[model samples]
Target: MNFWQSFIGGVLPYIAVATLVLGLGYKVTCWLKAPVNLHWELFPYPQTLGGQLSELLSEVFTLRSLFHHNRRLWFPSLVMHWGIYAVVFWLFFLLVGAPVAIYLGTAGGVLALTGSCLLFLFRLFVPGLRQISTPVEYLNLLFIFLLALAALASGALSDLAFRSYFISLFAFKPHLPLPGSYLVFLLLLWLFMIYIPFTRMAHFAVKYFTYHKVKWGEVE
Candidate 1:
């Protein structure tokens, strides 16, 4: 195996995983350690564990707050988030040798790509959104778009190929030459895995604390 191939397929996956775990841990630690001077008393806070879980699921799957507050951006945001969720599930099923990973990966790639494109255009052309949008936000959308495109392009291969590739990666075995599209997907995936933890993209993880602790936590 060539050095570039080995590094990309083998070494980089480990680094990306480690960075994601450690970086998120550090961010959560910082948030936990930060002092809170005031408590938010949001109305209709979920009192029971089941209620809280239901509320969390509602907010997550439906983007309930965004729909209520900013209806204009809600559809694309929901599509993008659901696409991300699908991709995550695809990864899990892929590792488990499930055939459904193929469908999940395809759906995720299409939805993510379409949603990101719409969001990027909204941020670029819409007057109100453009005014508030930052360069990093646009960059993040662009990154997702490209990553989804790569994944979609790579989805042409058999699921067995993907399963074997990942198995080789985790087992630290030499990798066979992957197709160009799959290689690109891997590269972008690694970069994204590393990049997200340090950026606002980590909001997915932070939302747990935001909703459960800050927004709905019991007042002392």
Candidate 2:
């Protein structure tokens, strides 16, 4: 019934997750709506409108060049990316599939932890690649690690720290407690998510450019 008990055990986290989903949805919608008007006419491949869409879907979704470029470079990057991706889908499943509950949260948390650890290890073992790794990158992975740790800690020693907070947020409770360390970590995590599409973090999208424009050189 105290600050940590109420906040970490209350509404803050659900609000955080919901806000993240809604905000990202809005941003991507706006970007997609605004324009495909700009042409990257650097390549000479001409195609019908249908062909462009087909290629875009295949290269972008399938991550063709992200695979073809160099398996060593792309494989680990793909694992890290797809891991985050699976986490996102898992969240979406939680948002829609059922009422929020401990099982979904725990599973999602575990999955996220596994993916992030793989990425962290990838960067650590791969030489030269570290040059491209930035403070933001380390911070991002560390945030995930902490979140996973928090989830496990709460489940074991700290009971209901994150879960109760989420339930409260979703239920529109006015009062709750939040953990200080968690609050900062969540804020940074949200910032990382918000910054994703706008930054090199968008290599997800850029990989498509490499595939279609540079690797295959199929821009029209």
Candidate 3:
């Protein structure tokens, strides 16, 4: 393998995945070590395990409260979230070499990219959200848009025979048949993984901690 191929296909994935795992582990450990708040707590919480589980699932999957609170925000958000879920599933299909990978993955990629673009624009035009939004938030959406855009372009413009490259990587072999556009996407993906634990993307972890320790069920 050449330098680019060797580094991008061979080494970078391991580094990204390792950073993801270690970074998450470190964050969870820090959360666990932090002093617990035994005094103050939220009211009107769920009492039963099933109820709590259902509530958590609804919040995570549907963003139910958003629908009630802000209809305008909810529509675009729902599109973006469902699109993300589809894209994630499509990624799994790709890894497993599923039969329906191409059709479903293409749909997923298009939905995600379109929804992300709509959300990015929405955030810009909404004066209230714009006032509260951080530079990092804009950057995060832009980064996601760039990733999806690159993936879509790679698939559409080039051959994008990514399966063998992925196969080699998973088998701990070395090869890089990726095109230039895909190279951009993969590099961005690696950096995204590395950055996730430090950003608001870590909300998934934080939610687990919050539900188990603070709000509803007691892990202690």
Candidate 4:
């Protein structure tokens, strides 16, 4: 394989994953270890650990409150959120060399692209959202949309050769598969990993702080 291919497909995945794990690990550890302070909020304060867990689960799986308060953005946001989950799970199974993941991942790529497009558009025309939208926020969404698009194209054009390359890497027999159509997609995937910790996407990690710590931990 060429230098760029070898680096992007092999070396950078490790780097990206390491940064994500360590960065978020440090962030969460700090959140938990730090002293708690009182902050006021208006709704649904959990009185017990179970209540906390239930609320967290709802936000993780369904993002329930967004539906009630921001119905216009809710549809695309929820769809894109699930799409991200499926795509991540699909990628995991691909690395594990699972055949079923190929089909599921392809479907996820399509769903992600669809929702990403809607979110991108909504960011433009949704007046309230548009007012607060930052360039970095749009950049993150654009990158996600591009990554999804790349996955869809590579899967269609190269017959899961990209997955095979990754599986090969994990299997200790790294080889660049033919057609090279997935190279850009793989590159974007690594960039996504690297960028995850710094973006609104890292809300996955930060939500823990928000719900259990800042908003509610003051009571504990």
Candidate 5:
């Protein structure tokens, strides 16, 4: 295998995984250690475990709060989130050599790319969204859009080769001669894995705290 292939397929996965784990761990630890000055009591909080779980699932899967508050932005946001969900499942299936991995990856790439494009246009053109959107937010959306596009193009160009390469990586034996498009996608994916923990994208990790500990924590 060439140096770029070895590094991208082997060395970078470890770096990305390590960065993600350590960064998320540090962020969660900080959140745990931070003192709570006020115990917020939102009205009509769920009083039962079932009720709490129901609420959490609703908010997570459907982005209910965003739908209620910002209906205009909800569709694309939901699509983007679901795409990320699909891609996560794709990774699991890919590692296990499932035949369904390619479909999941394709669907995820399409949904993510479509959603990011819509979101970018909304943030750029919509008056209210534009007012609140920052340069960093725009950059984030652009990054996701490009990554998704690259994923889709690469998968189309080299479905089998890419799958074999990733699977081999997990087995401690790297494969070689991946298409240039796949290499680009791999690089972007690696960067995204490392970048996520440092950005608001990692809010998923803190949702438990936000929903259970802060939003609905029982008062002593």
Candidate 6:
């Protein structure tokens, strides 16, 4: 990578993560300081705070969406999401601990690869989804495909492929004999996350906001 690519590949991701964290903090603080209670409805049901907490735990941790939908898309999406979460947790574990995941053997790698492959197939083979998929969607799928591929391949190679590919880029040595399959995938994944917040893909978040605005389950 050149100077700009180095900045983008190395510095931009951290910057984006920082911006996301700080922006979220600022928004929360502003919301707290405001006099108005913005979420008065509690929408579908008026629950006590404890009930809401229990609902949230059930929804997010247990992934209520997948169980509710129980479709091909949901299965792959759930797996890919969990795989990403696992990888992120592992990375944080490495940073704070003694890099214990390196010895996690093939189980972690296999799970990540299978989840990613499922996600890739979901995007590729599902006609209803594929018809509406954009370049960004395809690119995001490609990123996961490569990331999973790299993880699986790295297990068999003696080249320290995952570490060298990223760490080398960080050290300003983009010309290392490292496979860029993972790096490109990661970069594109971050880009997709950044873009999604500003795109129609935000419907994922927006849907919850307006969930009870219209009582669709009942007709007048």
Q: Considering lDDT, where higher is better, how would the candidates rank from best to worst?
A: 1, 5, 4, 3, 2, 6
Q: Rate the local accuracy (lDDT) of all candidates.
A: 0.85, 0.55, 0.75, 0.78, 0.84, 0.52
Tens digits of per-residue lDDT, candidate 5, 11-80, equal 8987998999999999999999986666577587888889988999999999999999999899999999
The true-versus-predicted C-alpha distance at residue 51 of model 6, in Å, is: 3.0
Of the two candidates 1 and 4, the one with more favorable lDDT, higher being better, is: 1
Candidates in descending TM-score order? 1, 5, 3, 4, 6, 2
Shift of residue 62 alpha carbon in model 5, Å: 0.4
**TM, every model:** 0.94, 0.53, 0.85, 0.84, 0.91, 0.55
Model 5 residue pairs with clashes: none
Q: Model 3: runs farther than 4 Å from truth?
A: 38-49, 156-161, 217-220
After superposition, which runs of candidate 1 have C-alpha atoms over 4 Å from their true positions? Answer: 156-158
Instruction: Give Cα distance to truth, residue 58, candidate 5, Å.
Output: 1.3
**lDDT tens digits, residues 105-212, model 3?**
677667678777877887899898778778898888887788778777778322335666777777888566666667877887788888898898777788766776
The residue pairs in collision within model 3 are: none
Give me candidate 3's TM-score against the actual structure.
Answer: 0.85
lDDT of 4 by residue, 46-144 (tens): 898898888889888787889988888888888888888887788777666677777778778877888888988999998988998899978888998
Clashing residue pairs, candidate 4? none
Best by lDDT: 1
Between candidates 1 and 4, the one scoring higher on TM-score is: 1
Q: Candidate 2's error at 65, in angstroms?
A: 3.3
